[model samples]
Target: MGVQFGSFDSICETAALVICSLVGTAQGIEPSCYSRNVEVGGTIIFQPSTSFVHIVAIIMTAIMIFHIRSKYTAVGRKEIVMFFYMYIVIELLAMFLDSNIIPTANSSYPWFAAIYTGLVAAAYCCLLINGFVGFQFAEDGTPLSLWFMRIACLVVFGVSFFISIATFKGFAGFSYSKPIGLWIIYILWPIICAAVYVVSQLVLVFRTLEDRWPLGDIIFGAAFYTVGNVLLFAFSVTICDAIKHYIDGLFFFTLCMLLSVMMVYKYWDSITREDLEFSVGSKAAVWEVKDPLLSTGLDYSEEDTVSNYHGGGVAPSLVGGVSGQQLYQKGGMGGRGYPPSDRY
Candidate 1:
């Protein structure tokens, strides 16, 4: 029975592939350009320009992680940091994949592609989840919020990975030749996630915040993300041909994506202020200002102390020559180190 079911599934996949190919052709869908190769010191590199951009992006993401860590008391610091970490992983894998470090004919190529697809989906999911972190729905940075984002992104990755692998290997009724599932996961899923994230963040900045600078960051992020997709999917071949194979849309796509990610960090940082008292790495500076009115009626003369002492032991005046500045330097006078309200 299992054999029969497998055969039936195979037949269905083949039919689906045929139908999808016809539909795709009718819709004018075609493969994007393959970036040009380069030779440096007799060593060949595939997608050289895009790969270099990916490396730079990875480094930038690492720096972003450091910046995020320094926030220390941002509302969603831990939660958003996860997104950048995943982005770094995706960029590293992209560098490997685009450079043909793992060639298409390699046995592990499909697995790498599957993992890349999954990480992309998970990253977008993380972005979407982060948009809601501002709403205090589950208390950002708490165990509940942090764990929920982690588990949800993990689930997204698993689902995306399974779909991508199944399609690549032509199992579970998924067809590599058609790859409708891949289109859904890779193309439509990101679009959905991005749209939702943008909308949510817009609402947050417009309705919830007093300052509107974050709105600009959000808009710039959306613009960069959109341009990246448009260049990659629509103009890659044209750009490659126009550039004489020296570069391609993939380079611009990667650069734009990096800018988009930076905008995400900018927007997050704009909305969340670091609490200096609890922040790491440096002590916050504190300034003490003496109020002129605080010493309006105070007397520190020894004569006053002796006079008050003779009159049934009233509280002694502050010792003479003990200036208000000296008292302040000594950290005030009361047991709790604050001056009495009636005195200086």
Candidate 2:
């Protein structure tokens, strides 16, 4: 049964490849320029490199869904939800295009592409947002430096969004032809965003060295995401030229998978630790006996004792086996219950 479904999926994928190839051939453009690779009849239809990426994306989508449904913290939950939402949108848009519901050959397709691209763009933006939120609400607390990083990320996204819009307009004007202006908008803008994010994250990692916190996770996770985006942008540029585009897409997909796994593990560990501590502490208190007789005549003369038990006066009988003499000397024999002379 599993094999049959798998075979069916492969056939559907091959059909999608055939359709894309036909569309590209009819439109006088390489189908490889559109995405990763193409496959036909259990063989390479256009480019084989892209096939692996599509496969990984399909697998990762399932894993992401699992993570989203499981227990997660507020930040983890938000990031997973955003990521899943973006992917869902992208998948739906892709299906729409593949089904010929939206014309990818005409000028209208560019608009459709741009809209779908914008949706895909949100995947990275949401990740950046998650990193910022994590840094802001870290165990130690929100720091000014983290806030600055968050703002910097926002600026980068804003600029990238603007450039993406311009790029889409250029594409709409030109039917998938290569243009320097288009390259600047599509390629350079994404590169800049990646570079800024990477550098900013590196700076944060170095600056917070002395701080006792989970700085490593933040730095490494951000670095993975940044590098992945950079590679993806490059892949988008060279997708038309060679099979390398598919390989690059595979790399980017793998990077995203790693990032998601890291986040899930990190937060899961934190949640588990917190639960463990609470469980142990609760159980410890549950077995505690509140014997007022054992505490009697104990001299809590030390300032630490008063400070420790400031909530209420310690019951003298709670002490195990101390004499009145010791109690008086320790100054715990106060005027509350026992008189001064009575102590001797």
Candidate 3:
């Protein structure tokens, strides 16, 4: 049954690919500026490379949903889940923009891109938040450094957001052949986010050195994304002739989502750890029994019960030399009020 489903999914994916290829061909992606070439009349063209990115986005989005629903968690994880939400939004917007264009100077493609920029910015914001929360929250506290990093990211985002709004950097097509200042506006957030992720990862490595196994998976996956983003940024800026950059898996975003999905899967509870003993404990306890893995909250009553059960037993008079029946006889220790026995 599972194999059948897998085959079915493969078939569906292939069908999707065929459809996308047709769409791209129909739109003249080969000569379209969206594919890195200018049309004769300046009509923006969608490229096959860009189409592949859309395919990747769709696949990863499906995988993300599977991971989230498998847990069946009904509450919390708002920030962590929000990261994926924004991820889907940004990816879909990229795909959606691929099929659209500013046919005229006054067309709405530019506006569409502008609105999408904010959503993408917000998505990257969640990614930063997840990075900090994943480590510090595991230890059951947020350090001053994490808080500082968060505040700094917000400031950067705010400044970048304003600049982008004023310049429509959200349109973000280097093919548009805009001036250098405007290009910087489009690339600002990616540079800043990648820088922050790399630094945050270093901090995580130091903080999690003691944890020998599980953290490695998350660390490596996140590193892949950070490094990929840096490389992608470089590639996008310098390698205009290469069509591979637009292909979904070849670009930074492919690395971003691929590694991110891995990290999310490996460390399924990045935001809140149910095993963190600090999250749940008795507040009114006079003392605490602390441990790295758990806490007892000085539960003396339970301790006493345990101790009593182990160290004590039934009454000697009732069970040892004297039986209950003999004890309850006339003139005995547990006797009725009657004539005394001669031995007593």
RMSD of each: 12.5, 14.2, 14.2
Off by over 4 Å in 3: 1-45, 69-76, 101-106, 134-162, 169-185, 226-257, 264-344
Q: lDDT by residue for model 3 over 218-269, one digit each (tens)?
A: 6676677666654443343333345533442224445465666557556544
Model 1 weakest 10-residue run by lDDT: 13-22
Candidate 2 lDDT trough over 10 residues, lowest sum = 1-10
Best by lDDT: 1
Cα lDDT tens digits for candidate 1, 1-344? 11121122222222211112212322322234456677777756777888888889998989999988988888999999999999999999988877777665567877888898899999999999998999899998789999999999999999999987787677899766566667777668888989999999989888888998888999999999999877765676678778887777778888999999999998988899888667776666777658986656665464464344355343433677554444553355443343544476
Model 2, CA-based lDDT: 0.44
User: Which portions of model 1 show Cα errors greater than 4 Å?
Assistant: 1-33, 40-43, 283-344
Against the true structure, whose TM-score is highest?
1
User: Which of candidates 1 and 3 reaches a greater lDDT?
Assistant: 1
> What overall lDDT goes with each candidate model?
0.75, 0.44, 0.48
Give the clashing pairs for model 1: none
Q: List TM-score per model, in order.
A: 0.75, 0.43, 0.48
